[model samples]
Target: MRRPVTRRVLAALAATATGAAICVAVTTPQASAAVGSATGFATRNGGTTGGAGGQTVRATTGTQIHAALCNRASSSTPIIIQVEGTINHGNTTRVSGSSCNTAADVIELKQISNVTILGVGNGALFDQIGIHIREASNIIIQNVTVRNVKKSGSPISNGGDAIGMEANVRNVWVDHVTLEASGGESEGFDGLFDMKNNTQYVTLSYSILRNSGRGGLIGSSESDLSNDFVTFHHNLYENLDSRVPLLRGGTAHIYNNHYVNIRESGINSRAGGRAKVDNNYFRNSKDVLGTFYTNQAGYWQVSGNTFDNVTWSSRSSDNNPAGPNPTSNTSISIPYPYSLDAASCVPNIVSQTAGANKGIRTSNGSCATQNPTSGPTPGPTGNPTPTPSQPSGTNLSIGAGSDGSSKASGTSYGDVRDGNMSTAWSPSGATGQISIKWDTATRVSRINIREASGSVGNVRAWRVLNHDTGAVLATGSSAGVITFTATSLRKITFEITSSSGTPRVAEFETYAS
Candidate 1:
């Protein structure tokens, strides 16, 4: 059970401060790199190195943080702000400037880019305040505590989210922070960490989210499906009711995290979303993984996870819990590099490393050895098996079967092999997968991928995978003639990893000649 927060102290502080501004002048410092490199999906999409190679400033109030953004020469100018002390609505105000768009009553990082807010000195606490990031990119928020935020209380901010990102947000790395609420949505608290509205390439690592009704979510609803490519690693989630993320639609890699006392549910992937959940420990939780509250299902690829004293709910149309003996419903191929600490060690590693003011310690992602620093090694784990050679022949896919990770609303997975150049298949997002399958093992080494007439050149990068063995048969940029060592398999997947637009494949022709 969580204790109620004492708001009287904070209310008195808010009352003492008048509407007058607290002037704190700051000078631009020498250029420097970010305090730490981003990991996971945040390392993708040109990487998130917030406030590097520009300037550094110190702030004691939320207003000063906004002033730093407003004072930048340009909205994209890189700047780091080290914050100390408490930030509430009273000390936060709207700052007008050409380079920034800010608002009162919340810590707003809106319509800006390349900024980092780091807590220092005695540590920064956003008491009853929320940090909102919207229409922003290349941002980092670290080593702070945000608590007791509410959407329906007398003093409200950020709709009760401790840290919320939305509206085309990109490349955000939120690490080493603590986000918590005293109670559930009925008590006026919402999600602790949330992203929506086309947000992409974000990572939340080495953090703690506890005692909240909702832990977080990727997309806002079943219809709001534009968000994708997020990662959650080495974090602690405890005493939460549900939505220990409610993933609506996206690719989320949740690894090396510790989940405890999840009262209702956890990792609720629904509405065609896919989650690669690996190397995690779930203890004393109920329905920790599954598609619940909806008939529309989601998917997950599970590996190396430990469940202790966890309970499962009975199967129903509105409650499908992946428990008792959870297994993979879909195979998710991760495009980034990562290392996994053994599942047995996740609880210990996360306890020592997750959250703010803990020396920013992290598990080296190796169970045998624990290092003080963070960052994953190069090369991806859980790679597919090696591809073997095959014999030359004609088009093997002409009469073969087809499937995919996802398909666009108007398209079908079978359309990739219908041999009709006009009818095509597209992913639900800008990037996803399409595959061809057979009842028996088949051999092939070549594939001619014909793009839809209007969608030609939409694919930027791709990989040919042996879906049967999860092996990387071939990788290249653009779709055309793809060749590799012939491999015999029941299924082969053509995965579009990067694209400028939603890719459409008219034909996925397979050959062996």
Candidate 2:
């Protein structure tokens, strides 16, 4: 059974989508601010809020990571560890403590709860080392890279998996990370991300797993069926041999991911594993989806997926490819809310936002990045207009072209300049921008913004900018006559920086006073 949803997930969606900081904790040497909110299955089981409002520390080596955990007041005490520089076997050692179960040559998060490991500054790289999570809950690992970890080599760690979770793990989120290997198990490498032994309520987002034989697995074997409720979205899987991943049992929601160059197989859902596959992009792959290697008969509910140049094998006891022409074989009911990008745009979006050291950027659910402005601007303090009166002068926006960073469904960019109060434009999220453009440069000192009927008091803060020069024209708290020094510009943008609700703009009028 699925867990209940809470208000924390909604708050995270609002804050991160609006480019507002979801402050985990801020201390010297590291800023514990999350780049994006938790989505997918992680929003379940009371939501994943790792180390929020907890003590923050900094770490430069793997041993320091263990030390921070060992130094915590208790195993379940919330703590955020901001990591930087390279962490390898040379600097990692087991630290014995009541709060930690760490080991040498690896970053171990064992028997712990409410902890966060975040990469900061030049970023954290686990070179030839892996992260092992065992019997842990409510943990997060973000903005880090783990590469070339091996199990059978001279320098082995985490049994060769880049990141492995097992033994009753729950509510863990791993985001904006990169896990890669030199080759496969024959080359001393293993799965990039693996979960087994009753693991549940986990999410892996905005990550890249490449150049490995196995991407990951849900269960250790066909009978290890207790693991379930995993989500994989906005990830890139490239140059993988097979098992991307080999799902043995339980349910997985895989969407908006880009898969390229699969040598043998992809998404080997078998042993009764069920996957809800949606809006994914597969290019140059072989047997991208199906029940492979096992006859246990896994099921899939496929929709909106694009298979470009993906090859399929004949249906047999060992190979059952879903494609050649894929269709849904089962139905799944997802519990949480989410936005899906078009399959055509998955590659572009994942390439820019996935992996580490990418400034922790995320999609605004509308295929646009949230941070388009130069820097953070202060919130508006001007008094609000309870009811904005229509301006008298000629509305310059009536005939101008209109565009925006993003728009809500059933709303249009043209609605803000349409001159009809009944029709309006609303952003996909709490904050967004709407701009008016002209064929030639236009000059105006005064502008009036009229909010839509039901959304009058929704807008809390706003800024008018000269879109041509990226200059702020005026800052205010409400929709009304906003005045600044008369300047000529080809385009002007009215950006809603913060809002109490989903604000809507009925009309944007410009006048020369």
Model 2 Cα lDDT, one tens digit per residue, 1-513: 423222221111112223442222224221232545678898899998777656666677777788778767799988777788899988777766788888887899999998888887767899999999999998888889999999996798889999999999999999989899999999999899999999999999988898899999999998899999999998889889988778988999999998887889999899889999999988778999999888798999999998877888888877889988899899999999988888877765665567766555566677644442211111122322212234567889989999999999999999988889999999999999999889999988778877775454356578899999998887754455677878899899999998754688898888775
Candidate 1 lDDT by residue in tens digits, 260-320: 8798989999999999999898877899999999998999999999987899989999888
Q: Which residue pairs in candidate 2 have backbone atoms (N, alpha carbon, C) closer than 3 angstroms, thus clashing?
A: none
User: In candidate 1, where is summed lDDT lowest over 10 consecutive residues?
Assistant: 7-16
What TM-score against the true fold does each predicted structure earn?
Answer: 0.68, 0.68
Model 1: C-alpha RMSD to truth? Answer: 21.2
Please state the error at residue 348 of candidate 1 in Å.
Answer: 0.9
